[model samples]
Structures are given as C-alpha cells and as structure tokens.
Target: MNTSTHYPNAPVAQPVARHTLAVIVDNEPGVLARIAGLFSGRGYNIESLTVSETEHDKHISRITVVTSGTAHIIDQIKAHLDRLVPVHRVVDLTLQGEALERELALVKVVGKGEHRVEAMRLASAFGARTLDASLTSFVFELTGSTEEIERFIKLMTAVGLTEVSRTGIAAMSRGPDAM
Candidate 1:
C-alpha cells in the first residue's frame, strides 16, 4: 500500500508579467557601470533605465528600470542587485506598491517651410514645448509616460524627424514615502 502524502490542492507558480525596479545607489563613479554589468552579465534585459542624483548632499542617485521577466528571474535580479557594493537599496516598485513614472525627451526635427510649421503645430498639440528653433530645425521638449513620448516621436517622424534624445525614466512610489 502507498502511504505518501496526497495533498493536491496547491496553487502553481506564475511568472510576473511586468516589473519596475527603483534603485537607490551611492552617487559615485562606476556605480552605473556595475549595475548595468549586473544586468548584462546575467542576460537580463532592461527595457528602460533612468538615473539622476536625487540627493546632492547625501550623494545618492535614483535609478528607475523597467523590465519583464518570470517571477524567479525577478527575485534573482533583486537579490543580486542588493548584494552590490554601491547599491544602497533595490526596490521592486511594481510589486512593493504604487508609483509614478515619467520621462523627458528632446526630439529634433529638420524640415522645410511647410513641414517646419506642421512639426511645431503637432508638438504644440502634444503639449511639447519648443526648446529651440531655427529656419530648418526645431527641438521640442516633452515630458510624460513612455507611451506618450513614443506617440510624439511617431508623429514628429512623419513631419521630418532628424534626431531624438531621451532621459530614460524616473519613477517613485506615491503617497508619504521615500524610496
């Protein structure tokens, strides 16, 4: 006779659909490199990455990264990052709680008379500010979600897109909290 445990009412493990990680690290040299290396070395992909000095006196920087992976991979990534020397904290913004995400993009478009006017009009419609202007070129500054920035870029391309630069993404948890 069989005398083994026969409890078959357990739930299966599911993979995480998406994740946003917010990392607080010392604002020192090689910090970004080390973090990036951690991702590349382990074959993880970074959909978006944004970093900036949040506290000047404390010399602390915040890095917001968007990525997708299974549940196991996400835990692995967090544990690995936490073990880094420069990393002060590694938080999974998506799983831990609610957060706000934003990004800034500077889109440069070069066009002739009509296209130039059209580009400006489109940019205005998208709430993008014209940071710079010339007879044949214009630089529009836009800040919003990644989807919004992508929409603006797609529209600008139709009007004669020349170049674009994005400041990645910066995110933080909502409410009375600091992470």
Candidate 2:
C-alpha cells in the first residue's frame, strides 16, 4: 500500500442534484433508443422516464426524464441531447422557473378489518381514490407530487402496502410558453 498523505487543497465533489428534463423529439423509431443509448453509454442513471406522443399530427413526442448528477454533468447532458438529430428541444424543467411536477401511482394493499379501514382512511386523507377492491385487497389511485406519494407509501407499509405502480413524473413550466 503506497500510503499517501491527504491534501487539504484537494477538490471537493459537488453535491448531486436531481433534475427533470423535458425532451421533445420526432415520433419515429430509434429516437427513444438513441436517447436511452446516450444515457446508458455515459453511465448515467435515470430515476424516472415517461414518454408519450404529444403532437400526433406533427409527429412529435415528449419524454420526461428524472436524473441526478452534479451541475456540470447536468449541463453536459442537456448539451449532448440538443445535438441529437431527432430531438427538437431539451428543457431542464427543474432549472426552468416554477415548474409543476406530478405523478400518478396505483397502490395495492392486502389486509382485512382495521387494516382495511385504516387503508381507506389513509387514502381518503391523501386524496387517493379506490380503483379496485375485493374481499382481501384494494387498489388505490393517488395522484400527487413524488414526495407526497412516497410519504403515503411509507405510511401504508405498516397498514398493508403490497405493491405500487407509478406513472413517472410529468412536468411543465408555469408560464404559457411551450417547452
């Protein structure tokens, strides 16, 4: 072991920050693959990814991605994505002023008696709707911010949270301008 002295002047790593990116691209084959390839090739991890064709006539699709990295790395990702042939625009929603973000989650809980009552009570408090219910299980539909969904899930774990399915974040700037 080459024991080296620690240097006080060494550079400190920047804090990793999570950001949401709204990518508009041509609704064609291989476009999504290219974007995925870019992230995978760079060894970047995406926390959440949502894609849908927003403009059917214009053949444009919107891709919402949540990722974490240092500020410089985030900037690099935006720049690289802008260069893709099919991509029309890449907007960092988090950096953009006052973006509204929301996610939809379907939470399933299995229980009986008080567990059932408690689940319903919690869901009602969280504004979650009962989508499906049976003799021993129930599926609740909740739409809220990611943090809220997480909190709800955490609380449900003690009651009877069996599974969860989330529709990744969908975000937009508060202004009227299109992204």
Number of colliding residue pairs in model 2:
0
Candidate 2: tens digits of C-alpha lDDT, residues 1-179 = 34354775677789999999999999999998999999999999989999999999999999999999999999999999999999999999998876899999999999999999999999999999999999999999999999999999999999999999999999999987877
lDDT of 2: 0.94
lDDT tens per residue, model 1, 38-111: 99999999999988899999999998888889988999999999999888898998876767888899999999
What TM-score number comes out for model 2?
0.92
Model 2: how far residue 38 lies from native, Å: 0.7
The TM-scores, one per candidate, come to 0.86, 0.92
Quote model 1's TM-score.
0.86
